[model samples]
Target: MPAPQFDPAAPLQFVVNAAAGSNAAASKREIIESVLQAQGRRGELAFCTPADLARVARVSAQKALSTRTAVVAVGGDGTLNTVAQAAHAAGCAMGVVPQGTFNYFARTHGIPADPAQAVRLLLHSVPAPVQVAGINDRLFLVNASLGLYPDLLEDREAYKARFGRSRWVAFVAACTTLLRAQRQWRLRIETGGTVRDVHTLTLFVGNNRLQLQQLGAEPEDTIAGTPGDGSMAALVLRPIGTLSMIGLMLHGAMGRLGEAAGVERFEFDHLVVRPTLPQGRRGVKVAFDGEVTTMRAPLDFRVLAKPLYLLGPQRSTATAEAVSRAEDAGA
Candidate 1:
């Protein structure tokens, strides 16, 4: 089926993550409103706390479908992922206005980081199919992980709360978390009808090729071109000492993680992982697109059967190379 066409007269539903940034929500609101008013386009802004993100996104997405409009996600990858879940489930078109650190999803999809620019672009753009992956029932656009990676995200949030949000602080937080890492996950991984057990510090899945590239976790031709042209990638980090872990961080910082020792990379369409947990524990901490949450064991990770339609500006070859036809009519 083809994507819904862009209807300028229809009201665009914008779900704002109130807890994403330190800046005043009013300032962000003004920026969005100014662009909409200047273009004479109808837009509805719904500001909700992080605690209310899931609920608000669901409501906004249903409203968008009812009104025959696109629901816009305005924040970081976590916000985008949350909104994407609702939009994908409803088969509604979605737009993005990036406002978080890294902005990997937006940048990869060619959505401008500047709120006004992104909104303006979406106002005149049509929707195209974009590949999205899932971990259990939750959607993750950038990446997803378990064990040490999730722990790192929790620590990163704490560091951000105290030192403010920035790439540097996130790095420091990751280092802090790595120095104390000791737990190792023993997982039974099943893929392609083959099962294997392994011990790893973290099992990370990648959907956005840009991120995989940055981390040097390239997966040949399977990592690019969404919808029918690409597959998801996975990375496994073997347990290592603190000093070795520090070296691993340096490799990642320098964009050579794939070449780092004790690191394994592979591509797959679907995977099932069963982790051995402590006695009496039935759930495990998992992080998807920067947000950490507890999920029941026996995680199912796979490329979703249906792609989410994204409305945005056509990007240059550089940014959209990961998904070369992401903005095309046939995408």
Candidate 2:
């Protein structure tokens, strides 16, 4: 796809997610205005509450494609996911303005936190196509993890209400749950004509094909590749003893574990996962961009290559290229 065009003379429309970032609306508005001033551009802002993000995103994306207006997602990953997906479906271009606690996607792609810097990048940067992950019909911008982590998203609203947006607080809550969580999953994974029977603790599917910070890498060396490679990666983590699981968690926390033998990782265009045990019949808890849903026993996932027009600094291209090469070489 071609790069997204920006006309400084034209107004940039922002669909802001007000409920994000600790429910601090005033600070977000100030940041937006300051960024516009810094970019020397004047634009219109549309504030959206959490309840409105999905509908507003569709409207904004349609308007952007129809009128060729610049639409930006100004919130955390979830907000970005909603807007970007709409833009992709509508065949329009989009940019992201990170304002949430963990803007991991933005940071990985070199999107600035300061609205002005991000706007400047968006105005001048080339639009690079980025891939997305989808399970059945649901799409995910970042990786989706099933099991204990997803269960956290199942209670996100309550957790956010009680703990606010602090990652530490969320982590504590998750750990508390994990202590009693059972990993009695019997999974059948099919990829590249091979079907493997595995009992795992978690299943994480990443569209960008990159190993996340805390999450382990795909056992098949899939994450080292290009983001828009038109392929998806999977990391199937078998359930170790709880004590060993804790040790692995610490290793991942301290940044020590990557591509260990115990973990199985693979890359594919499509796959199916089914449970072998009756207790697993209710299906697993699946998470899509922080939203949780209970899925049937069998799950299907695929990669949508070059689905979004991402704006970033000039260095992103080089970094992405390097990563792609590394993935190809199984680095």
Candidate 3:
């Protein structure tokens, strides 16, 4: 497929998620409007709650598709995922305004963290192809996990509710979850036509290179050489004692998980994971991006053949600098 051309004069449709981080402020609307006016761009803003983001995004995307404009997601990765689904379906370009806790997708694409800067960048940026992966038919931009990881996410949400949201609080919650987790999954994994049975604490499938680097699983060369290869990297943590698990957590925190023992990493175009026991049928909890859901046994994961067109700075400058800094900082 040919790359979509970006037009500076094109109209933009902004889909805002009010519950997103930094978006709940009353002044945000004024800031966005001011920026659009300053840029002399035609833009329409629509607000929606988290629950209605997907439907609103689809409506906005359809309008953009008909108008030959771009649809911008003004929230986090989950919001971006929702909007991207519509944009991809309509063959329209997508942009971001990064108002979330992690904003991993936006940061990786070299979109600035500041709302004003992100808006300006998107206004002048071009459409670039980005790879996205899927578990069953649901798409995810970052990574997806099963087992202890999903449980940790649930615990993290509870912690956030009780104590409020902050990086330190999230870290503490993760540590607590790690210390208390006692379960493991005995699973059968099929990839590349080979089946293997193993006991693991968690399984992670990653599509974002920066995330893989942060986890210390993929080397710089591998990532640089195949930035959009339409494949996902798998990191499997074999069952281990609590002490060893703590040690592994420490390694991961320090961005050195690749050197951690009992870690297995591989790349595949498609794979299937199922419980080794016949009686383990009740469906498994899988966490994608920041959302959790239950999928029946024998989960199917694969790379999407088509790429999503995202509006951001070209890889040669912005992305290269961000990646270089992350590498230098050992992140």
Candidate 4:
């Protein structure tokens, strides 16, 4: 891992999120005190409710504008996003202490979920400028989602809390929605200086590609993995009929999308999605990092390069080479 770029002697502000992954977020008082005592670093710890995150982040950023203080987010991706935005706005570096569901960024970056280790990293690790995205006026550290996935996130915690896993319930919900929901939007995607029109079930614009590949007669799915790179992927799923949807599920059981013709992948720095006809006039749901919001037809998605400082380990050289290849292709 790269060394922390900040001075070790600087004052640190630890922001703890108490409602991150579950019904309520966990408290970090014990861990915070322990880490502070262990490190002997003079720092102030602040517990933030969900309502206080934005305010605290903004305030921290403003203070950081003049003072050499580092702000740490002690929560999940959303919380980290808030902190990143504020820290970036304040022109200060931020660190993560992941304590939430689907700690995608943390997992990828090697930030430990353990509070003590996270604190150690925050104090010792170097902070580097990382990439972030902006949806309209809002900023996001990870990729954004548009379509069914965003809607699913509304109930993601509820369903996952009840089931302990997401796939089965998500698949069922998606199937049920597909059966009843009408898929009638036309999207004109412009990528790599080429324009293509497609009618699709859902559109995913992600900062990285996640791979969930397994060898079997069953379906193999992957998650996008590259969120920090200065690019995004567009996964367009073609609209299918009821029978086709059933076949798709069967293929998923076999570990692949049975009909793969319409699954087109596009990479671009900017995207403009325009509705085609009258039925397509119905707006789509767009989420900036899983928070759902309504967007009119012709949604525009763009990438903001190196929006904030992230402290994480570099992927292996081979992985870096492969990523370079992928970026070259996408470019």
The per-prediction CA RMSD against the true structure, in angstroms, equals: 4.4, 4.8, 2.7, 6.6
Model 4: per-residue Cα lDDT over 66-185, one tens digit each = 556678888776788788888876677777888765455665456666767877777666666566777656677656766555765766655667777555775666555556546555
Better of 2 and 4 by TM-score: 2
For model 1, what is the error of residue 214's alpha carbon versus the real structure, in angstroms, after optimal superposition?
0.9
Candidates in order, TM-scores: namely 0.91, 0.82, 0.91, 0.76
Q: For model 2, what is the alpha-carbon lDDT of residue 241?
A: 64
Position 185, candidate 3: lDDT: 86
Clash tally, candidates in order: 0, 6, 0, 28
Q: Provide the lowest-lDDT 10-residue window in model 1.
A: 322-331
The residue ranges of model 4 lying beyond 4 angstroms of the native Cα positions read 1-5, 19-26, 161-181, 210-227, 246-261, 276-284, 295-298, 314-331
Can you write out model 1's per-residue Cα lDDT over 40-112, one digit (the tens) per residue? 8779989889889999999999989888889999888788989999999888899999888877677677777
Stretches off by above 4 angstroms in model 1 are 19-23, 221-229, 315-331
2 or 3, greater by lDDT: 3
Task: Tell me the whole-model lDDT of each prediction, alpha carbons only.
Answer: 0.84, 0.68, 0.81, 0.63
Q: For candidate 4, which ten residues in a row score worst on lDDT?
A: 211-220
Candidate closest to the true structure, highest lDDT: 1
**Tens-digit lDDT track of model 2 for 1-331:** 6655645456666788885444467777777777677777766677878788989988887877666556789888788888887888877777888876655567567676666677667766555666677776677787777766686665555777886887676656666655666765667887777888888777877765344533545335453454335666676766666686666666555444554434666677777877664653566678877777777767887675546766566655646744554344344
